[model samples]
Target: MLGIVLPAIITAFSLLILDWLLPGITIDTVTASVLAAVSIGIVNGVVKPIIQLLSLPLTFVTFGLFSLLVNGFCLWLSSAFVPGFEVRGLVGFLVGPIALSFLSTTFGHYLLEGRTPASLPEA
Candidate 1:
């Protein structure tokens, strides 16, 4: 389906972009990037919400800044399951996810602009 495939491709492409920009982030091959992308999506979808729920108090105490740790943990955990994809150090842990988020948003917006329902003509 376009819905699933599009986001996965975007995530993979965003990982490749991060690999290029961040020294601490290394994706050995295109396959690794794609695998990592799927892994990240799965982790974010399944694990992130539980972690977020558990960390609700901290998240509130930190004024939502605690989400950085949750996001970074999800990224790191996903990397552990995928070979040839490595996120190293604090920069990779924190900044990699941050950069990935930004790149994914920007790329997805431009690439998916015309595909959105708002662009469809009224029936």
Candidate 2:
């Protein structure tokens, strides 16, 4: 779906912001960006549900903090798939994905689908 794929692509660019905002994480180029996006989407798609299912109790117990770990795992998994994208160590591994989740949530909420809150049909 274009809805999903395009947001994932945009998320790759958001990685640029994450790297800038934090440190020790890098995605070197458009190629790496695209690869990271696609790989992350695939990783999230295939792995996230399973992780969520397995961690459901923890998710409930922590009031969703474990979701951050799942997010970080997806980023670490993307690092495995993309050559030029790297998360240097544990700190970056933990912070990078959570930061990325924030960036993607902000950007995707405002930018993607070409519709703002003012333009949407009323509930």
- C-alpha TM-score for every candidate: 0.92, 0.79
Scanning candidate 2 in windows of ten residues, the lowest lDDT window is: 114-123
Lowest lDDT block of 10, candidate 1: 114-123
**Best lDDT among the predictions, by candidate number:** 1
lDDT digits (tens) for residues 24-117 of candidate 1: 8999999999999999999999999999999999999999999999999999999999999999999899999999999988998898885774
Q: Over 4 Å off in model 1, which ranges? A: 117-123
| Candidate 1: C-alpha RMSD after superposition | 3.0
Query: How would you encode candidate 2's per-residue C-alpha lDDT over 45-98 as one tens digit per residue?
Result: 898889889999999999999888887877888888899888777677788887
Q: If candidate 2 were superposed on the true structure by all CA atoms, what would the RMSD be?
A: 4.5
The top-ranked prediction according to TM-score is 1
